[model samples]
Target: MEGLRHAREELRPRRREGGPREDRHRRRTRHRQPRRPSGKRLHRLRRARGRERCGGPEVTATIAYDRPVSNFIDKLSATGHVTHKSYKKTSVTLHHNGGRLSHQGVLNVWKTRPASAHFDVDASGAVAQYVKVNEYAWAVGDTVGNQRTISIEMANETLAPAWQVSEPTWKNSARLAGWLFAKVIGERPSTGNLFYHHHWSSTACAGPHMDTLYDKVLAAAQEAYDHFKASHPVRVSNTEPFPGASFFHTGRKSPIIAAMHHRLVAKGCDLYQSHANADVWGPGDVKSYAAWQTKLGYDGAAANGTPGETSWDKLQVPNV
Candidate 1:
């Protein structure tokens, strides 16, 4: 009992303000990181430590933001999470994985969970397709959203408290979403068509940083959609209306006449030698029209060089 009392007395001084042990403890902790409060700050510190241990925050791979069509790798997931039924594609749903996961990492997770997205954008912006866009992906946690939307899962450059996505990931996502919107839905991404996972579900999927940048993403998507539309114009049927017989009078210089000449030449009825399919309704135009009429099983007055509505319509003259 006496020895225990003596030991307690010796340790009591160490608990005092200016004790020897407390001084040594202070010296040891002076150069060390300060004790962080148990809240968002501490959570971030732990996340930073984990990030450093892996490969630092920044992704090293250099993938182009606007990659070619061949760059889309198909790393399709198992059929368990994908519904084979085709659905009407109406919107694009953006998401953040909430952790630093690679293209394959996201797939691995989906294997266990009953969740999957159509596409996964890695930290370097490399895209891996998991499900066909025509089919439904078991994402967005809502049946309506999953059935109508093409979900894109993006990798985070940093972990939670601020699940920040890399610049490449977001940029590539915007361009890809734009291309998809244009090709599938025939419209630019708008608030009505483009959505976040949280928009339909109970989770904050795109995170705070990406949530604020949805407007910028929509802008970028619109630009890409416009470029795509310009590059690939819609093909309309080439059925021009018949311009009537009075429109083809002699000495008349109209683009309609030039178009008719070209069609005649294409149909092996060309007799133009000196005019070279010019817009003027000269002897060449008459000869070409007479040949076209003859080729169309016309005889005598019907095969005359005068333009007729039936033969003119049969010529399939294109608009100027």
Candidate 2:
């Protein structure tokens, strides 16, 4: 019995041994890796630019944070902070990791590699930040290019001919780029500002998927930018109460549409016959808008219920 107790104690690892405790823990933890949350998950990011459109419910960014990649003195990037004209960020460059690595797994690589980026998007549409907007991230393997552009690294679904990213990842990347454009450039995402890593590196870093789907991504980004602006409305001197397009053709509901409805009612135009609520842009709103246009002296096809620029201006839905 005494021999059995001594044998059991001998097998137990001692803390005073020359080897570190982590060595033993590493061996023990090998098969018990930490699990990432499953399914399509979303997390919101609170940035300096997110403070706008504070009243009512607004669309905040659904962003996730991985461990940061680049750290600097006083929390600055390679050449200071990101800016409209400072970083030259003339464009948003896309790249593929060329492997099916997790977003966090890519971060681990970037920690030691000579290159890094502002953001990394995984196959599941999860985004991880390796560098901040205020600092420069090494993309395209060039100093000048890195300083002049914003980088988004994507994880490929596979290697070779398919060298592609999942649909969700593509959408998330486009949305992120669009969000960045609105926040930093103060403009909508356009083809002119969307680019590929190959544009600088002369290598197919973005892979065939981006090569074939660049246009689609740009279009998606444009939609996202428009959606962001719509959700975050600002009352300007030229603010159009009907949003950008006509309420008649509008398929979505907005405060602007509600305002348009109230104005149509005030103008004594016969809106929809059902007399529904303001949250929806129904046939009534369209019919009433057309009538309002006619009252404003827009005749013929000019007042076809569609909000033309002239009628939109004349409707005079005051900016909220």
Candidate 3:
């Protein structure tokens, strides 16, 4: 009896009578991230733990944020607690909002639910994030998939497979996926690393609408990536920049040279003399380049049909 009384006394805090107890769960451990409102689109990249993992391919091997197509971290007021210790994000799983829900609608509903997702694309082409990229969120309703995938909830115009999202929404989602694949994953969508919610759960989650738009969305990701690469053109590796000399005169044969021909063709140059999409620098390539040069106010030797930095910049030749 004495030992029990001592234990109780020791455990009791020296607080005043009727004092209020602290509520640990209600503590303000959350803070809002700064929002930038300028462009029609929004993109944000916030790295945690000083290490950013790759998502898919479209960029370098060590994937970094290459101006995410529209990475807006429109975080919800409340997010679920992380349920796992460690996770490896291997793929992107797409889910439908199940209906035409707005961004706020999803956030408000998710605030009380025991669930969250990395991103959500609404019918307005708006992207709202409920979870951080470096942290895990309650999605997929399974262990393996949830621990190994970034979940994306795509908003639909209707539940129908034919009208999965509004044209803008579909296009924007594709652009977002492209950005994620490049920034999060290190490659484009392939047989590996892309999935529907149905792939993980028994429910027809993404529905026929997503099923019909799956491939198209993937294609848009590719197009978005290509457009990004075009604007930020990198030098073709192992290939020297055009030396301000004519390829026809030097008889240079190189794959980079062939890629140049492709760009010239795309630039509305008549490269019939050169085999369509040929890699080697041939007389046909020179003829086509000469025409492009002439169109740019060059005449005679200046229009000798050789690639120059100015012309190349405007050509938008992809780093193939």
lDDT of each: 0.77, 0.67, 0.64
RMSD of 3: 20.8
Q: What is the alpha-carbon lDDT for the whole of candidate 1? A: 0.77
Question: What would the per-residue lDDT of candidate 2 be over residues 213-320, giving only the tens digit for each residue?
Answer: 988999988887777666654422444422334224445444557777787888887666865678577777778888988888888888777777677777686543
Evaluate residue 269 in candidate 3 and report its C-alpha lDDT on the 0 to 100 scale: 87
Question: Which candidate tops TM-score?
Answer: 1
TM-score-based ranking: 1, 3, 2
Pick by lDDT: which candidate is best?
1
For candidate 1, the TM-score is 0.50
Each model's backbone clash number: 0, 2, 16
Global Cα lDDT for candidate 3: 0.64
What TM-score does candidate 3 reach?
0.47
Candidate 1 lDDT, tens digit per residue, 1-320?
99999999987844558789888998988899767679988898899989999977633232222342222223343338778778889999999997988776887787788888878877545577777786788889898888899998888877878898866678778888987887787877899998889999898789998988988889988888887777755344364445446556677665667788889889999788875538889888888899999999998999888889899888887744
Candidate closer to the true structure by lDDT (higher is better), 1 or 3: 1
